[model samples]
Target chain A: MLKGETETELEYANMHYFFNDNTIITAGKFLLPFGQFGANLHPSWINKAVSNPGIYGGHGGNGSLGGVTSIMNDTGINVANTWVLGDAGRIFTDFYAVSGPRQEEGDHGGGVEIESKKGDNNDSMAFGGRIAYAFLPEWEIGMSYYSGAYSDDGDLNYSAYNIDFNWVGSYSSVRGEIFGSTAETEGEEEGEEEGHGEEWVKDFDKSGWYIQGTWQARQLGKSWLNPVEFVVRYSDIESDFDGSIEHDFEEDGGKTGSRIYYGVNYWLEPSAVLKLGAESTSIDNEEASHTSVPDDRIFLQLAFGF
Target chain B: MKSIKFVFTIIVLTTSAFSIKAQHVNDPSLVAKGAKVYSENCARCHNARPAEEYSKKEWSVVIPHMRAKAHMTGKEALAVEAFLASTLTADVRHAEEYTKPNAPKKSGAELVAQFGCQGCHQIKGEGGKLGPNLDGVVANKGEAFLLKKLIDPKFNNAASAMPKYPMNKDDVKAIIGFLKE
Candidate 1:
């Protein structure tokens, strides 16, 4: 869906499936899907031979700024101010709030994310508010804060903030942004999985951030026929569990070692583009990473505008 | 005289050697030749493409259409097709015509707009319409009639109110590619 600053709104959607070999099957509300499908004969008027992914980058995709506003979960239809100055820079002020899943602290020394009665009364009805400004084209900076309300009426609030900077060069471009999150949660007694008659007063906090850069179109064999772009970023987070919660949970301080991302974007066409990337995150104190997960992934994307 | 002959021979050999050493595959002259052919045989009906809008497929389709409609035979059709394809496929941003240090710059969209073409045509679903709807017209009309119209709009339509723009060989060929989309 598209709603121009001026002009009536339009609605649209795209559904597509991909096979491991990279062959794609697509069907949508409008227009022929990019490649072939069962019982779908291409039109003679349409030159399928000239069909190249590079032609219409993200032509028929759903989401990412072009869709019917009505289809959006309008529970939080907030407003934000946007300003762009020529080719040199841009600035924007955003205000937004939405409801859904939220982070809840679990029992100490327990399976991560599983809630036991003794842990903490952190179940929540959540709400968030943010006011931020960005100066762009090359350089940018920003900040935000959020909070959630627990069922017990006790407060489990957390605040998050960030700063960023970037540069655009002829052959390639680079950018770096840092973020920090701080949380103060009220804790319960030592071994209680369920609520106990006496509630203990305790405070816990968590904070972390990262910086990353990307170099694109560097001199390489890929640059001759196709422009290849590369990006890398590393991030880390640490938390301190305090008071009675530490004794029962057996976790007073926890840290996420570091996460690294390596990504590449290919310019398949003037308007169409594709990105492939992967990430690996190591744990500082655990025998295994979360899910013992492999931080390797590859994806291809295409975008086009009409 | 003998020494002079030796030096001349050496100069010839040296020139030949240097030329061979330069070995810059001189980006296929066939396209250049095709450009000339287009200007001479097809520009009257189809204009060349601007830097951004042309493509190889467009040129290929154009070749056959010109052969069928304008009667361009073997060599002429091939050459014009080559030229049309070159501009269509070359990165318009890096093309010399676009990158001159002091060259007046206009966004490709802006150039398309300035030609007053948007008044009658649209690319990829945008533009006005005093002319035949051109979205993929290149795929249909081929190059012959398009180039011909550039030189003389009335060649195909005695009553066409469109004025024939002043265009040389390269410019006409270039426009053909631009309209390909």
Candidate 2:
């Protein structure tokens, strides 16, 4: 809705058959099961902060992802199961093969990351998976990775690695995500010339990370203030390219540097939230290739999920 | 590096799978375990809904969807399924039977096992960290206070997440007795 190209996304519609009480084999389009964010935390109702850290790669968002972008879900078959440990601690695992990402004309894959694209560009299939260990009822640590060919001829390869974690405590909650990717750029014949620096031919070297902390006022002994959450987050994406250009954002100058956000959210219901926040996004000038400073802005948002 | 990681993932999953075993569907302890799983996993995604709102049919659909969405283990899903199923009626809730006592006075160990107390509190290094370790709980908190706390989790802190089980005085006494030992 924010991008105005409101195309409905049908990311996955498939079948999951349980082999036993602990194992499952699923076919057709399915969740990539990468980091904690996309699989477990992306739903707006659950997210504690207003801005997404650039770890989970995608075309465009408040802050364009750096180093690596995740195509959330795609056509594939997956094997997944959980192993309960001691009494409550358990390790969860997921693995799958998908049609893989395709290299687009421009840098950004755009809002079309999911629904608009149809068929794989190359014959090569992408493989990836995640493994996570959760314990203490409120804390989890995990790692995820993916690799595949995205070029038309299936020569150029795209691969990425991610580590993420989250812990919810009685008085505070903290979470973070970090991911990086390296993709071989498919060269354009038009700009091909000897000894000339062609950006397209340069590998997309991008990486980003962010950490957020949120606390409740329950300790104050005020019931009314307990529902208010104060959140602060710092995130950035730096690479060989710029986000506005690479992600196909319609903005004037496509620069992605670093961002910090301070927000206060009040809960009306568990799913409904009223958010008031301000953010300062600074583009690091040292990274000359993909550099720009977007203006800081304040926002008031009323968001809820059914 | 990628090959090593791929191999590592396989090893973890393969080894974990060997430990999977079929559960006896009628086990009453599942309800207690399910109660813990639901509290731990559900509040992360959305607000907690009372079991009163969902019928057995709605819960059947909800549990599987939640399992896939949150990547819950089959055991976790089954335990929660059993937990919610037991809550359908008061008689069913209280009647969810543990093993019948062979003798008149049930052993403290039996009550702990029946209630799945260690599912949250670490007992002899074999439980979750949801609750404080029971190793020194008896000494720190008196036996009388512990009994009252079990009867009323929010007796002191109104915001405690501890669930109130429909246990009688003898059941509570057994748990306290086991801790004192």
Candidate 3:
């Protein structure tokens, strides 16, 4: 069972059957294999930081704060396979088709609505796939692409493309990812002709990128405290729309900004961590009237993977 | 409602089946081989977690998931499961033993070697060339100063890459004793 701020839901209820050593088929509501961040690192325990990167929060929506970038669970079928490359390399590929996101009636007033990307109903089908290659024990690279219908009328559509890579050495590790997305919106002409009051279409072009590096102290010396890790990360998200649109991207606290995060993590165990970190956010449109200054935040989080 | 029930039923049965198949192995040679596999493959990405961290059931679920991510073959995965099951279920010290007073006491040189201090600090003409030479430095600095540096290297030097060792009092004293010698 998965519980969120607004809803308590079952995140993934999937059935998988293995065909052989290298192939498997799955059916049910599953996490979409969209990108490395969403598929692997979005979990609170697995993610290095307290908060997710701004871009994984998904794009354009009602004044409400739900988007599809992270935890995009959908009802569908997925086929996955792995192939060994030489002695120390492997290639993995996943293909899936699932019900896409939808805009549901929001609890807030003023005709505001929230986006429901989870598998509520198969209003429209979206198809996508991901391919990843581990060239060495310490290195991996992946590419992801997803496209689906997002509107009840099937007029609005969405598409996303991403590239992510990770490399881990004896003492330090580096990870980076960049993604861009496009979604159709109600044009100004449609809003005017319908006479139904609605917000104008914000820019549909959205892109985000982040790079993180972590250094483990235990590798350098012998101390019970040597398991401490120093981490530094920088992330940025840009939208085609100016600050005119009132809707907030759920993850970024409603503003497009560049963020620098530095933190220290004490590994109680490999799967458990005590983290202290600070994030500095610089809003892109400081002069805009509707834009609010995003304050730098300090956080301490205890995360453990069971 | 019916679909939910069906899904729930399938999950219960599948989990039960997996649990039935999971068992611990007592073979020493196999356990040793599993340990080597874990150190070589699992330690490549992150620190190898202590086996005592999870129960057999927990490892039953966690190992398969990680096996998929780490691209472990069937045989390798099974060996890792056997290793984790045997180790975690057996009497063992937790990974953070240095924090406990009951931790096994080691000589200062053994602690230094265990922590790979020689990789960066030189005792005589040996060890890595990154940090300052430690030869005779302990005599120059008193035991208090040495203890402070051991507990938190960054207390005096913020830029120091030296990690905090969170050692028990006895372990710190032992290391200090070795340095004095």
Candidate 4:
């Protein structure tokens, strides 16, 4: 799931049914079961950085470091289940089918948006699933894959995969995810003016990853300092599509560069947190058009869950 | 703006409280289990949401959404529901000062139950198996170790899923005393 795409209005509404302890079926609009950040850690109380990985932007954004990936919520039906493997291990799975990507139109035209929020432009539906394994009770690793038609003509297609892992120790935690994707698109030289203009077909590829670490300030001694946490994350995304319509791909977080984020968070209580963070981003593609260059930033925020 | 927000919070909490009392449950063990699950699972993503933030109906919608997204077991979802319900039925206001300074003295057993230690630590052959058995842990680990662990569960292991409780000397001593018995 992506952050910038979230609307202040109803984010999503879905109903789920449990067939058993290990199986559940959900219908209607819901969050995309993509990577750890979109599916899990996007919530303010949980995410360590004030800003998400630039590569995870969905749409409506042209962050200098943005790259087209995917959205956070869409109209879909998903089934999830868990299997306890003996006493020490477990397997978890989530599968879904939904309105896939749509060809971008209007201001930034020629590319794909990666989510059919207005509903699927084509009759074809998208499909995806994630499988994960848990061991040592506190450690987990997962793999996810998604594929579907993204064009109104249903001839153009997009596919992506993500690998993620998480581990929790008494005083620290580590988690991260890697996402890679490719898409086929056609734009007339003039992007397609009937039979009058030559056709250009591009096989665009993009990929990115982020790793985060957090350490609890337990050894710091003061009981009042016990709730403090130090966190750091690194992220990068790259793309091969150098189309003239750079904004179209950048809307989906397709800009190529790397970012480093470091922060500290203090828990006012179990349900409230105060955060101080700083981020530095480096851009690689000088040809990409952006209103402003990707810049380093510092921020402070208070997030209360109640 | 602050006044409006506070009023909104109050109205939501008050309405949810009414619904919770109608179906109030007093099962400490279930609440304990819910407490443990809520922290261990939910904390990984963000701060724990206060139970009164949602009505039972809202939680009905939220829990299932999370259950599917997080791949949580049905049992855990139910445990969290029970925990939230128990909290909503509580008379205490969320904005009220927490853990009052002049709180009445509680028995070590009460402290143990309040902290939900048995939810993870095996206690007299009962409770969970995630943490080490606490049946005779006082004698085995020594009082000093237990005291440190209580204040900072990560004192011994950085990755311990065990939560910390910053208790004053009296409460820590009482917890250790109860473990010895």
Candidate 5:
């Protein structure tokens, strides 16, 4: 359980039973393995930068418009396995069924609400899978797909796809992910009165991507400075929707912005890090004439994991 | 009194056996298997770190955490632990040695001799004939050039056959000082 200033939450509660060396079955709420960033870098100590990239943070109001969000967890069951291929490297796969996300009332601090909790809201079950191949010791590529109903009435549906890659070298590392999603909104016809009307469905598209790189100071032959690392990241998100759709979308239509982050991480130890960085965000709102001004900010964080 | 003594002996023997089992592995086949498992499983997400990078105690914590992320079975995790325990001995015995307040500082000439520079290059007319004489190389090439060569000879001379030394900044400075003298 995680305790915060305003709320107490259970981050992950699960049970796993390993059937053998190659297979394991898990039941409970687990962090969704939708992409590399959500699974591998969500932990404060593991992430190199002080703040998450715009795409992965699930902030900036972009994900609400059918874009990919950094889903926290899903109440479900998962089966995962790893297969070794000798010289060709290995492959890891996860197959899961879960209760998918439900849209919240309004935006909270620019963050979208697409994470499902313990209680079930929809009768339909969502199913998806993630497949990753480590072609080499230092390189890996993964692909993920998830689809399900988005509304209690089941008129609205969404499907998301993600492709991610990670490469590590002796002195440098690079990670990147790109995702695209589509949501269909079924609207009632204007002519019909009261609660009865013809249903009209419209599809919206959302997509985002980010690439980050980190260089270790030891590459300069300064082993004493091995704890210091330089990091840089660039990210962008775009959400396109039909203005006629009867949804409370942002005034700017949806979050359409790009961000660049420059930072350095100092490791107090292998498990702890102090991060300092600056972030600049640029919004390309189609209705920029009336949209709020964009601002740049500095980031500072101290994170550790025991 | 006799029963108490027998129970104490049993406890002492069992504790010793458990302690020995936990400390290190002596089986060569298990160690080899562990080495292979460590290399294959740990290298998937990140670079494989050398065992000497962390203390045995540190590994005790790191291994279990990574086991969950990598989805390793209990037996596989144990094998990997055994491999690291058998091979990755700590480089420093004690933390104090790293920050020894009164540790004797070696002189420039002593640093040169420690690195065996005299084996290839001559300083003040005493050394080998494999490389150019360093008697005036410092004056002719400049301190910056000499420093670079010392760190990496091939950077200047592509065909150079000199081996690179893993010297820190202070060691490089001391070697330069000895060459100037």
Candidate 6:
């Protein structure tokens, strides 16, 4: 070991009763020269079946909370050690309706801004894990799998599963994820066909896979007076599904997105840096074929390490 | 038309009054405020000296920390900010000095200065009782965690009696750099 010194660190933060219906708790610990790893847990206080419209894909009633636990290692292995491995796992109850929100959709905590929706909460559970290893200092490859459940407003049931391979490198990282699902709808009542109450409908199971990648680069110390650095990156994902959920949900064969970022890091002193960047991403989903909504973002950051 | 004008005047006056009231109070001159608060409230249980005479970043971390531990109010805390800002070095105003072909090597005093390692504990190879001795600290606590401990002690040990230091980012980095060297 090229011994200078090494140490371990652990940190935790918790916030309860956020937005009147949710609680969040997180914990992290790292071993020196190794990197850091942590876990995040969210528990809901309301019933998912009949909660808010946007709470859990309608069909909301009482629901259980779920969470994601991850372990990441930065491997101080350096050029000599060369190879590193990262592993993580996530487990949840009623995950289809809850976990999907945090991963596939936009953030709910838009600060002071609030959006409202309605529907009964769905019930489901999901669990999965991933393991990846770096063969070269600039590249890594790995795989992951997850499975969960989905429940209708009535006592109907549905299940979902996902598997994927990941490749990571110094300038870019890519992942290919395959997903599938099965569902059974409740039948409508005899007199209320329009309401579709108690009506049981079955859709062919659906499955598909998509691939995404992100790339980055940086430049530093261009001039003594100006002394600035630059960084840029891009990413995308696409998948296909066999069925649709009427006006609420649809199975698009796939979707594609492209993003661009440009930034500068200005060093004011040996210990401080001021960063500014502009970013934009465009996406075309299979279901929303005509609408092109590309997102643009801008930001400024001032950081000091001393 | 006359009634509308009258109401508009009233609204303008009310709005101005509220804005004036909402303005934060600058109760004291900026200099010495952070130190004053530290000596008056925090110094009793914790040592008042800067950790190895930490940089602006170190102070930034330590200062905000006094809030949760000492229960200092928002207004009272602003005064502390002014004091520390004045003492610490300015922003990355001199980037070239760092990236230069031959930057000066760190002197012993400068090393001690940044780490403020002697502030709470002893070095050479022994110093204070307020915290553990550093001779053993460097062995297990690499430069990173040590710097983290200086700025945010509670993160390392929730039960630690050590309070956070409110130094800004640069000062923390400066201290961290020195320790690493």
Cα lDDT, all candidates: 0.38, 0.66, 0.63, 0.69, 0.64, 0.34
lDDT of 3 by residue, A1-306 (tens): 876455456667666554456765667777777777766666565677776665654231111112234435677677787788775587889888776655444442111122333334335667788898886546788898888766667666778888889886657779988887776655343346658654465436677888988887856555554657888988787766553433432222244667778999886655778889887777675444255654577889998876
- Number of the top-ranking candidate, with TM-score as the measure: 4
Rank by DockQ (best first):
2, 4, 3, 5, 6, 1
lDDT, candidate 2, A8-66, per-residue tens: 66756666666677677666666678887767666666676665554543333455333
Residue B68 alpha-carbon offset, candidate 3, angstroms: 3.9
**Candidate 3: which stretches are off by over 4 Å?**
A1-9, A57-68, A104-118, A188-203, A222-224, A242-254, A286-289, B1-47, B69-71, B86-181
Better of 1 and 6 by TM-score: 1
Give me the displacement of residue A102 in model 4, in angstroms. Answer: 0.6
Candidate 6: where are CA atoms >4 Å away? A1-125, A135-139, A150-229, A239-244, A250-256, A267-273, A285-298, A301-306, B1-181
- What would the per-residue lDDT of candidate 1 be over residues B1-181, giving only the tens digit for each residue? 2343345335544543432111112234554444334433322222223323435565555455444333343444565554444444243446575567666544434444334454334466754322456677677767887777776655543323343443345566666667664
For model 2 chain B, the run of ten residues with the poorest summed lDDT = B94-103
lDDT string for model 5 (A134-251, tens) is: 7544678889998877666655677888899988654578999998777665557766455666767777667889899998775554435656789999988887744665463443
lDDT of 4 by residue, B136-181 (tens): 8877768888888877665654435454453567878888888888
Where model 2 places Cα greater than 4 Å from the true spot, the runs are A1-5, A56-61, A64-67, A106-117, A188-202, A241-254, A285-293, B1-28, B43-48, B88-181
| Separate DockQ for every predicted complex | 0.02, 0.19, 0.11, 0.18, 0.06, 0.02
Can you write out model 1's per-residue Cα lDDT over A1-306, one digit (the tens) per residue? Answer: 976454332222222222111122222222211111100111211111111111111123311111000111112212233343443233433333323122334544221221122223433423333332333223344443344433244454444443434343323444433444443444544455754756554435444454545454433323243345566655555544433354422342432355566666554433334556565555454532223333333444454321
TM per candidate, chain B:
0.38, 0.63, 0.47, 0.57, 0.43, 0.35
lDDT pick, better of 2 and 4? 4
lDDT by residue (tens digit), candidate 4, A8-81: 54557665556677887666677777777777777677677677866674233323576546656767677788
What TM-score, computed on C-alpha atoms, does each candidate reach? 0.40, 0.70, 0.67, 0.73, 0.67, 0.31
lDDT of 6: 0.34
Q: State, as a TM-score between 0 and 1, how close model 6 is to the true structure.
A: 0.31
Instruction: List per-candidate RMSD values in Å.
Output: 25.8, 7.7, 9.1, 9.1, 12.7, 20.1
Give me the displacement of residue A40 in model 1, in angstroms: 34
Give stretches of model 5 more than 4 Å off: A1-8, A58-67, A106-112, A192-197, A248-253, A286-290, B1-26, B32-65, B71-76, B87-181
Q: Give the DockQ-based CAPRI class for model 4.
A: incorrect
TM-score of chain A of 2: 0.82
Ranking by TM-score: 4, 2, 5, 3, 1, 6
